[model samples]
Target chain A: MRITCPICGERDRREFYYVGDAVALERPDADAPPEAWHGYIHLRDNPCGVTRDLWYHEQGCAAWLVVTRNTATHEVLGVALASDEKGEAR
Target chain B: MVELAPKSPLAGLVPVTVGRMTLTEVDLGRLTSVAPYRGRDEGLSEALKAAHGIAAPEPGRVTGRVAARASGRDEACAIWFGQRMFLLAGADPDPALAQYAALSDQSDGWACARIQGRGATQVLARLTPIDLRPAAFRRGHTARTELQHMAASITRLGEDDYLILVFRALAGTLVQDVRQAMQGVAARGGG
Candidate 1:
């Protein structure tokens, strides 16, 4: 897989590390019930179609990225900087 | 009182040469990293320009100062690491920028080396998975990438000249990897 970093341009996948689902960034309420906290920390949906994931360019650019990809085919649908709330990418 | 002499990270390793290429460590003076707080990048740039008489370059690019450093013939340069981040060598941090940015001294954290020769790009291509063609990765272009599993920053200074920076702890490993890659390029050229 190849990831085109917004700042560093295209680079090999080995330079990046998979950071799991992008949704994890939104933290659940701290005062919520025990079951709600458990679900937020340990449970995740296994989507088959398009999925949004977070990736860190550990060895390239050092920028966090949001990668939309197809689970079945492993095709990358899109990529964006995780810091960019507007979802802009080059 | 005791006096101490500064030693380069590669002080013990002999400079490597393969074909016409040479890899030698360069001791940089007053290296600093500047990072602006959120939404303060524009102000930081202006402050740097006003104080240092130069503007920071955009990401993936490098700009050189008009004056050369006392230790080297090459003009002093600043490399852009990423958004709101820059690495300046041969220049001191602007005290005026403290209001807009955070500054850190990086002179000892990184080890820099200059690579030059007829086949310098070929050897670099073998180590880094980047399209190093002259047209695509033109002069002044810079990138932070992985080399032999170690993080590195590469800046193209000229057609055959490049400045590579790696962590000080991994300097030996990086040089060793470059030596082996250069040998491969030389062997191919000789054959």
Candidate 2:
């Protein structure tokens, strides 16, 4: 698979560093249970559909990006910089 | 400088040594060997947190030292980041490799890059809000933040020091963006 970084241009899939889902999660309060902090920091739902995720071009300029992809196919639905709050990712 | 290996990927821009062999390049001279990089893709957040560190005898306004451990050439510079290794070299850098520094703010380490050369400063000035002046990001310090179109952290190794940070997803375009910015500087100079 291939993805293009707005700053670096076209590159192989290997160049990127995947961050997980971007759908906002709730934060646990300071006195919250220990499991809450662990879940928020280290857990993922691992859904298998169109999902919004965060990725970085670790090999390039290291831009933060929001990517839409299909987990089952490894096919990227769309890509955009995290800075782009409202652009069509595809 | 000694002769170069015929099959080096960076046969033109710089002559550096990787592992135990001196490689060739088109622009720079043949020099020492450098190492390859493997990015933090799987379990990155954890590794990143580990890499970020602090600086002791803080770098002044404009000072830095060359880190030439494994890489053969006079390229890579070893930055003092508390207890981390920050390598910077455009000659033949593999962005895929780990390039990070620990932060005082968060557990996650920030990714960074050392982009040097004459036009490097001017190139960054075009996309960032921070002053490129020596006073703003002097030699030994590192700053984590976002710029123009990306979320990144930058550091100053010297006058041209830049520890540009962005998500690994956008790593591919870093060189070109800076290149285009440099081109702008060149054009302005010509004009």
Best by DockQ: 1
* Residue lDDT tens for model 2, A8-40: 445556556887776332456889999988987
CAPRI grade of model 1: medium
lDDT of 1 by residue, B3-57 (tens): 9998887777647888899888776677888888888888987877777666777
Q: TM-scores of the models, in the given order?
A: 0.91, 0.34
**Model 1 bad stretches (over 4 Å):** A86-90, B65-76
Q: Best candidate, lDDT-wise? A: 1
**Residue-pair clashes per candidate:** 0, 46
Docking class for candidate 2 = incorrect
Task: Give native contacts recovered, as a fraction, per prediction.
Answer: 0.83, 0.00
- After superposition, the stretches of candidate 2 with alpha carbons farther than 4 Å from their true spots are A1-90, B1-112
Q: Score the docking of each candidate (DockQ).
A: 0.73, 0.04
RMSD of model 2 against the true structure: 15.2
